[model samples]
Target: MDVPYDLTSYVRVLKLASTPSWEEFSRVALIAGAGIVLVGLIGFVIFVLMSVVPGSTPA
Candidate 1:
């Protein structure tokens, strides 16, 4: 409804934003990396279980 009015301040704030510090960037990267690893491990475990367990799948 009030598109331009809302985006006006948001655009100004983005224009004034600065690059992330090394510490901040590294923290974000570490969290993202951990999330990716966790998902990958979960997928690998599911795959192993599928092959190792009999009648575990639906027909």
Candidate 2:
């Protein structure tokens, strides 16, 4: 309900933002990439199992 209060809070948040070092950026990127690959592999396994199993879905 308070516009000024919200604006000040937003400013405070912006003030805390900073650029990540190359090492830190690379570490985060590697972890994110690994998570994405892991999720994709799990989804692929589920899809393959569903297609190969009998009566898994209505034909």
Candidate 3:
């Protein structure tokens, strides 16, 4: 591996990368939050179904 070349490439990426704007960050956060809530809701539904249905889960 070329250490100097790798270091230069890493530096170039760091130079180009910038923090997200507030609006952009908020949109990302909202989408991520929705996805998390969605997954949790699905899991809760599954748990309720398993608890209510007979023989669906091991006693």
By TM-score, the best candidate is: 3
Candidates' lDDT values, in order? 0.96, 0.97, 0.99
- Once model 1 is optimally superposed onto the true structure by TM-score, how far is the C-alpha of residue 14 displaced, in angstroms? 1.3
Q: Mind giving the per-residue lDDT tens digits that candidate 3 earns over 1-59?
A: 99999999999999999999999999999999999999999999999999999999987
Candidate 1 differs from the real structure by a C-alpha RMSD in angstroms, to one decimal, of 2.1
Clashing pairs in 2: none
Give the poorly placed runs of model 2, Cα more than 4 Å off.
none
Candidate 2 lDDT by residue in tens digits, 1-59:
99999999999999999999999999999999999999999999999999999999787
Looking at candidate 2, the ten consecutive residues that score lowest on lDDT are 50-59
Worst 10 residues of 1 by lDDT: 50-59
Model 2 residue 9 distance off true place after TM-score fit, in angstroms: 1.1
**For residues 1-59, could you state the per-residue lDDT of candidate 1 as single tens digits?**
79998899899999999999999999999999999999999999999999789998887
Q: After superposition, how far is residue 40 of candidate 1 from its true place, in Å?
A: 0.9
TM-score of 2: 0.86
